[model samples]
Target: MKKMPHLSFWQIWNVSFGFLGIQMGFALQSANVSRILSNLGADLHALPLFWIAAPLMGLIVQPIVGSASDRTWNRLGRRSPYILGGAIIAALAMFLMPNASIVVSIMPVLLFGLLMFALMDGSFNITMQPFRALVADMTPEEQRNVGYSTQSFLINAGAVLGSILPFLLTNSLGIANTAPEGQVPASVIWSFYIGGSALLLSVIWTVVKTKEYPPEEYAAYKGLDVKAEIDPQYKGFFGFFRLLKITPKTMIQLAVVQFFSWFALYIMWVYTTPAVSQHVWGCEIGDSASQAAQDAGDWIGILFAGYSLFAAIFSVFMSKIATKIGRKTVYSIALLIGGIAYCSTFLFEGGEMMHVNLLFTQVDVPSSAVLWMFPMIGVGIAWAAVLAMPYAILSESLPADKMGVFMGIFNFTIAGPQILSGLVAGSVLRFFFGGEAIYMLVVAGVSMFLGAISVIFVKPSKSN
Candidate 1:
């Protein structure tokens, strides 16, 4: 195999910069969507069902985008057009999401919210799947870990910004955190507008600063048949299925790990608001809009910011030890820590448990939100690994020509599990956990532990 020439650090940074916007959009979506859904009168038990749009839309979009990007070449190059286009659409969706009531005044609020939710997620997947492929497309095998770890850093860094925005606007900028009944708050609405603008600007920076390889040059470097013409029979319609059939084994093994990791994440994104409101702040959020519920929601954004801060600080650093400790071991250990952390949220005892001899614990939840920050440390570690290692390992195994399709297929491991979570989480919450959202976090911890084990079964590529 021909060894691809390594680019300087700034080159890699420029190319990966687009992920900052993509993840910022994602952070805003995940941190706020549940609160938005709750405000629209979604029942606690049905929260997971409302979240179905994101993953299901990704399942439909990623593979198709991936397959299509593999064949496309234009003035914007193979991937930039998709990145640019998706960012614009998703930014519009972001601005419109907080206005769900006004955006679909004629339709029922929840139904309209679902449509907007799917558009945001679908547009995100369009940008996201290509970005993952772009990393594989641009970097050499020896630099894959560095490429992905840097991507992880940017992702969490953007999340830090997006996650904290509403809280900052509410507290520092004096935007109203609470609104009239059935209406979204000014704090969240303003945050979305500013975040949408930032999303577009950040993506534009990447598109302008970076250049993709011309098709012939890329094919030649990857040892593909540069001279071969596309067979007309398989041109437009048959591409995705044909590409799907040829997915690599390492990708399949990694899929098992992805499924569990994302399933845990889906539960976290969909339920964390209500869980924090009820479990920590002791607020009821059904039909009646309480100031306490809004406060709890903003605080949850802070907790998410805390986690993103940890992930950003630790993300790129994972690359240093990934080779030394072994990628699988590092990934597994990180997730084990996260799994244990998720389960420990139940141990808080309301910030003043030192005198209680019956429980026998030293941990005190001095302030309610401070206690929640503890679990994010472990989650940050796992997030770093999940973003970097699987892709670093999988990039080495994928056929260069089909990298996009395989990455999209790999996304199914993410979207498919979240889809399953949507199907199952509500029932499990109502029937098994007696409508407590805290237990769902416990289930997430168990799922992460299982994901850690599954990743160990994957074989590292020869390039590694």
Candidate 2:
């Protein structure tokens, strides 16, 4: 068996460069989707239901794309074709989602927005699963940590830009942050446009720059029979279930951690805008139309950006840190810090004001909200680990030929939790917490702490 050659840093970077754009689109969706839905007249309690589209789409799309990509070998390469196709559709969805109000006569604006959201998320899943397989396929075991961390860095870097774009547009470029009732804001609309453009262009760069190893060569590197077909038991509709039964012990252990981590993430993405608005900006609950609510929404973008920035910086050293301390330790510690960060929001009072410098301009924002940035540092640390460590660990245990399909199956841990979260989070917020979004974040914190503990049980491959 020929060992997979070590790729140069630039080669690894090019392999995962598309993730920057994919994450940019994702960050935009995360930071602004609730705001858009609120403006489109989605009730606060129903936001979770609407958000189910994202994880639902991921739950369905990823494994299918993963399975198909495993069998695919084309001129554009196994993963790159799906990556490019998904990018195109994702960009189109980005363009259409914020403009759903424009199609109100064709369908209800809120419904249109939700459909677009589903489409965008589906496309994102299509692109993302393949990218994960690509990294695992191209990199040798020794380089997997570096490959995934680089991907994490790019993902967070893109997230920073995507998360902050609306704030930048509103404060720096003077785009209107608030819009007429039932319409998305100009700032958000423009941010989606820019994000879509970035997504398409970045994916193109990866498709153009990176070359996949041919089947024979790839089989040689991974010590597989070049002419061998996929195992019969791993085929057809029930095949995924069969594959699940035989999944690696490491993958199964990691699933528990993924569930809690992604559950907390789903809560953060769905509730953060409203949580910050009511908790730290003094906006009335369900007041999406108010100036205060709009201001809070815009500020949430900055807060999301702050966390992503911290995550990006942290990811730069994640591989080295994981190397020294062990991956599970790093994963556990990061989640613990993130759990504390989420719980800390309760301490801030919304009255104080602070002037922040942005793009060489000063803007006044709630000082209490600024304090959120400190917690975001911890959130960022956890996020860096969340994006990199599990995959790094799992890739070592996976069969080389099944990498794409298994990666897709692993996403069940991610999507399933978010799906469960979406189903119950609204009810939890309303009944348990008296309609307070902030309390849901506390729930998220506890979930993260559980994830921290769960990571301790995962035994990595001996190579690690």
Candidate 3:
């Protein structure tokens, strides 16, 4: 058998660039969906429940998608087809999401929007797993880190744009900034439109520009036959359940970290807009006209952008930081820093309480820049490990043929944390803090601290 050629830098970039589009869709959903739902009259306490579909769908979808993609091989390629399909679905869902309030007596529109989001989200996960595996399959062992870094950089860049679109479009284009109660404003509508287009185009670019290795190449890499015995019944619903019964102690131990990280993230996603408007600007729900709400929406976008900015800057520094003091130490410290940053959300309300810095010749302390960078720096460092380290350890330990199934099952930890956060964060705020959105940040802080502490116990695979 011929030795596989090493991929060039651009080759890695081309294959990974699709993540830019995928992350953009995710950025829009994470940063703006809660705020949009609030504009559509979702109560702060109820927001978590409304957003439950994303994680729940991910829980059901990711493993199934991963499993299916593991067996798939087609003309468009195993994962590229899923990417194109997801982009199209997400685009349609983005178009309709902001329009849900239009058909006044049709409750189904809301459910339809949610269902479309689920489909789009699930399809993306389907593409994501195979893409990760592709990187491992195609790259030489020495270049694995660089390959994944390119992918992460693309992911964050896409997220930066996705998180900032509302601010740029609303402020720059003069779109209708506000709408009557229960309506999404024109600015947000346009943001989603542009995002959808970018997402579709970026993924298509990757699909066209890059090619995956054939099954023979893949089989040769692992010393397996190109053709294998088929077990069609292994694809059944109960198959995942049966597989779920056996799991690694390492994965079970890491659940502690996943639970905390996801809980903190969910709190931030669900309440950041309300927390900022209510806590910083003293704008209560229905307190002022839609303009106040619109201002709140724009500010939310800016704050999300702040985090992304920090995340991008920090991504470059993560490898160095990890090298100086083991990856676990860096991860633990970053979590602690993130906990501190989350705590800052409760310290100010309605305006700037602490003078932070200036951005673009404007005082940005409280508007969206305060403490935002700090949390994100921590978040970025944490994200480095979240995407790579755990998987690295797992891949080194698991049997090669079973990688697909084990990795699928492993994502359950990510979904499990989200489920816990969705179940708890809202009630904690309502009952403990009297429905104040700021309190949710405190809950997030605690969760981060807990997640960080769990890092102490993560024993990387001995083989690695």
- Which is the leading candidate under TM-score? 2
Task: Quote the positional error of residue 464 for candidate 3 in Å.
Answer: 12
Those runs of model 1 whose alpha carbons end farther than 4 Å from true positions after fitting are 230-239, 285-288, 352-366, 462-464
Model 3 Cα displacement at 14 (Å)? 1.6
Residue-by-residue lDDT tens digits, candidate 1, 1-464: 46677988998898889888778888988899888877877788888888999988988898889878988999889989999999999999998888888855599877887788899999999889999999899988778888898999999999988898888887777789888756788988998888788888988998898889898789877988877776554456675566567667788888998988888988888888877777776655352268767877887787787788898888767888986887888888988888887888777534432221112122222265567889999888888888888999888888777788778888888889999999999999888987778889999999999999897898866522
Q: Pick the candidate with the highest lDDT.
A: 2
What is candidate 2's lDDT per residue for 1-464, written digit by digit as tens? 99789999999999999999999999999999999999999999999999999989988999899999989999999999999999999999999999999998998999999999999999999999999999999999889889999999999999999998998888888999999999999999999999999999999999999999999999899888989988888899988899888788899899999999999999999999999999988888788999889889988888888899999999999999988988889999999999999988878758778788776457887889878888899889999999999999999888888888889999999999999999999999988988889998889999999999999899986321
| Cα-based lDDT at residue 304, candidate 1 | 87
lDDT agreement with native, every candidate: 0.83, 0.92, 0.70
Q: Against the true structure, candidate 1 has what lDDT?
A: 0.83
Candidate structures ordered by TM-score, highest first: 2, 1, 3
Tens-digit lDDT track of model 3 for 1-464: 45567898899888888888878878888877876776666666877887777777768766766676667678877566766776777777777777877665767545655665666566666656666766665665556556666676777788888887877766566667677777777877888888878888888888898887677776776566677754554547776676666556666777778778877887788887777677666677534245555566676776676666666666666655555676678667778888887886665555554453334323233444354455566565555556655554455555444456667677778777787778877788778888777778887888888988998998866322
The positional error of residue 91 in candidate 1, measured at the CA in angstroms, is 0.5
